[model samples]
Target chain A: MSGWTSVLVGDPRADRMVPKTGFTVQLTVFSSAAMAFLAVFALALSLATERLADRWSAELARTSTLRISAPQDQIAAQTEAALRVLQTTPGVGSARALSDDEQVALLEPWFGPDLPVASLPIPRLIEIVEIGDGFDATGLRARLQAEVPGAVLDDHTRWRAPLVAAADRLRSLGYISLALIGGAMAAMITLAAQAALSANSQVIRVMRLVGATDAFIAGAFVRRFTLRAFAGAGFGAAAGAAGIFFLPEADVAGGFLTGLGFEGLHWLWPLAIPPLAGTVAFVSTRTAAIRRLKEQS
Target chain B: MIELERVAYTYGGAELFADLSMTLAPGSFHFLTGPSGAGKTTLLKLCYGELIATSGMVRIFGQNTREMDRDQIALARRRIGVVHQDCQFLDHLPMAENVALPLTVSGRQEEADEYLADLLAWVGLSGQASQLPPQLSGGERQRAALARAVIMSPEVVIADEPTGNIDWEMSQRLLTLLVELNKMGKAVLIATHDLNLIRAAKTQVAARVLRLRGGQLQAAGSEL
Candidate 1:
């Protein structure tokens, strides 16, 4: 078999050459488990932020608003004119002026309920839903400025841009966190493998004396650490996934914090952590073993 | 077979040995004798491709030691069984597994299984087979080291002080084993301070003895 295949398949006799118990074993398992657990959380954070960003982008992109700020006597006239202008506008799916009660509810979070809205000269608000590719905001603004002088058109671009950017940045941070976790795990595994190799210097010498190739000697360490990382990461990922599952269900009222869990096939992402950890361990341990063997030689 | 032509070794900017020439033809027997500071072990390491000569060609199985990479040296080492004075073994492994190590590393575990039992018995180590190396007495460790060295049935056996720590009777037993191996047509080279052991071997096998001192190698004449 090829050297890599032999490393993965592992010879029991070859593995027996290394001592079964040592601090490196525990260190590798613990570090892999801890890193994998963190990686699962990072993955969830990335996926959740991606979902949030998309939802905000898509929802905000599909609708806009119009506000008519005018004299008390001219409010009705401008609202009617704004609605008429929007109706004829291409790509404007529908437009409706908000009822006083709806407007009051929107303002209730900042201003307390039961506010006297009719007594106050509040600006009239119009909700515009878009269809297909949506209306060109510049054209719609020009039309509203010409036809309804007191009306202002908002395409929600200003608000959506920053919110989506923030979420996108957060998603990127999550991915960066995952990468850091992977890197940290690799570093820890490398150190552990180096320590194990140093501790087993006598073992290495004997193996070398007995005609063990560097590949065979290194395969023993790589196989052991790889399996440990795999097993540890498996348990860690399962635990992390379980923690995410038991989190409070996503609530529209609870916002992004409540939505921090895998959805559908995204759950499969954590399943890859163990194998990825195994691969990292394999590479790192192999590198460390080969380097140490060369130094010893 | 192994050969060294005008081989010289230096350590820490000082020449340990120079102008050394030797050959281990198939079935030949030779002994290397030297003072404590002499570079006998270093010369043996050159023969097995463990150390590169400072000046001259040291070839193992016809390949120059200087030109062989670590992997190539390892491959060549498989054909050269080496018994160290300290009898290095994987302490965690049992005596049987330790003896079978050469075959195991060579991916010939089946051959190890075939030969391990009889080999252990031949070395008078059958009773200690299941015990660990640390648990074995000095003599048993020496015998086990010899068994391990020959497990692959290497072409030549290079041993450095093979009986360094064992009793006289145990040393004689180990020497007899080496004699039997030489009779079987395997070249053998041993380095030791034990002139008595060399004398004992000369009686049974036509052995050539060489001495290394003051960075020079010379054939010993009537030394014993």
Candidate 2:
């Protein structure tokens, strides 16, 4: 704990021992900023995809559709019989047959305006909402088969499963992208740190001759690089959050493209990127510094 | 105190020196004289825990160099001040900060603030405290290096060619400061090829002279 605190609250005199101006400084800051910007996008994508999966699963899982296809005279009788059966089921919350106007409106998107609901032999659709554990599909199907010969029940299991799985895979991909970004950032920072150490070999030799410990020497470089990374990452995260905030608002017509951003308290997540980048810098620089100092000895 | 027991050092595939034994006791002054590539600097490094002897033991302040980790060596180094021929310093830092570095590294910066002015004054570098190392003259840089070396008040002082780059006057001044340090009961070991400087030191303090040649260490007998 004291080590960590010292890394944060560095010794100014020791810090002054290292040259402040070098290409390695620019490299560390630039790479951290760029990676942090990319990380923000990855985090947002992961979270957005997760929310999409849950929303789709919940909305689709709670409701089902029953389609009735019969002789024109028997269609109403079969829909009513399906609705009646649904009403008596233990887990069925509500069931209603779509009126002609409602069915016309539902089909309008596919069939243009003023869809001819009465002229075509379109199947009568009854929407069923579930409650508690949800009604057993097999039992409902068996009863519907006995009471209504042309009725078929769809619990949305096939559609919901595939959609949720795809969304989950996308979320995993987003998280994997985040990991890759972090790894690439670490590699870049390590290279930059090694370059700085090599450039300041004289400084290190002087410090060592003056009885400076490896921890003291390493702490100087670690603190410098860590603060650089933290500052750069903070800037990058702020820019990214601003970019995300200004994105087009979520719209039903826009669908997936519109919903690809932070929602509500999720805005707080990107705040962690700066500290995480600082930590990565601290670990990578410290490891590289210690190893280099050992080799110098 | 530092003790070397039949210490041997090898560079690349060949042996540089072997069966080299020496002891640096408190308040003693010794001069190591050798030709170029005679392993004087390497021996000094071994004495300070910078390099471990390949085949023999080097004990600094009662701890074996082979047995000590890097941190332990570093801690032991705090008690042994070393002055390099090149007078190494952090070029970017001012002279005052560079001199105070020993104390800063040891977490004794407050003591530096107390005695730094006095230390610089002792070396006659009080006016050049804020100047960068690159701006200082050779003699001034050497003095600064001396100041830095002794700022920690180490028990033993090892200097490699302390007067190699300066004129006769500056060399004497530097020698006077080192002689004063010896008088204060700090062990001093100087490695140099300067016979005149050795003769000059002998008049001020009781000093032993050792010569290294052909991978052997021999005590000099009235050669100076």
Q: All predictions: root-mean-square deviation over Cα?
A: 1.2, 1.3
Per-residue CA lDDT of model 2 for B1-224, tens digit only, reads: 89999999999989999999999999999999989999999999999988899998999999999999988998999998889999998888999999998999999999998999999999999999999999999999999999998999999999999899999999999999999999999999999988999999999999999999988999999867
Error of 2 at B98 (Å): 0.8
Error of 1 at B215 (Å): 1.7
Positional deviation of residue A153's Cα in model 1 after best superposition, in angstroms: 0.7
User: Each model's C-alpha lDDT?
Assistant: 0.92, 0.93
Candidate 2, what DockQ?
0.86
What is the model-wide C-alpha lDDT for candidate 2?
Answer: 0.93
In terms of lDDT, which candidate is strongest?
Answer: 2
lDDT of 2 by residue, A1-297 (tens): 276798888888889989999999889889999999999999999999999999999999999999999989999888888888999999999999989998889989899987777889999999999999999999989998999999989999988999999999999999999999999989999999999999999888888888889999999999999999999999899888888888888884478867889998999999999999999999999999999998998
Q: Give the TM-score of candidate 1.
A: 0.98
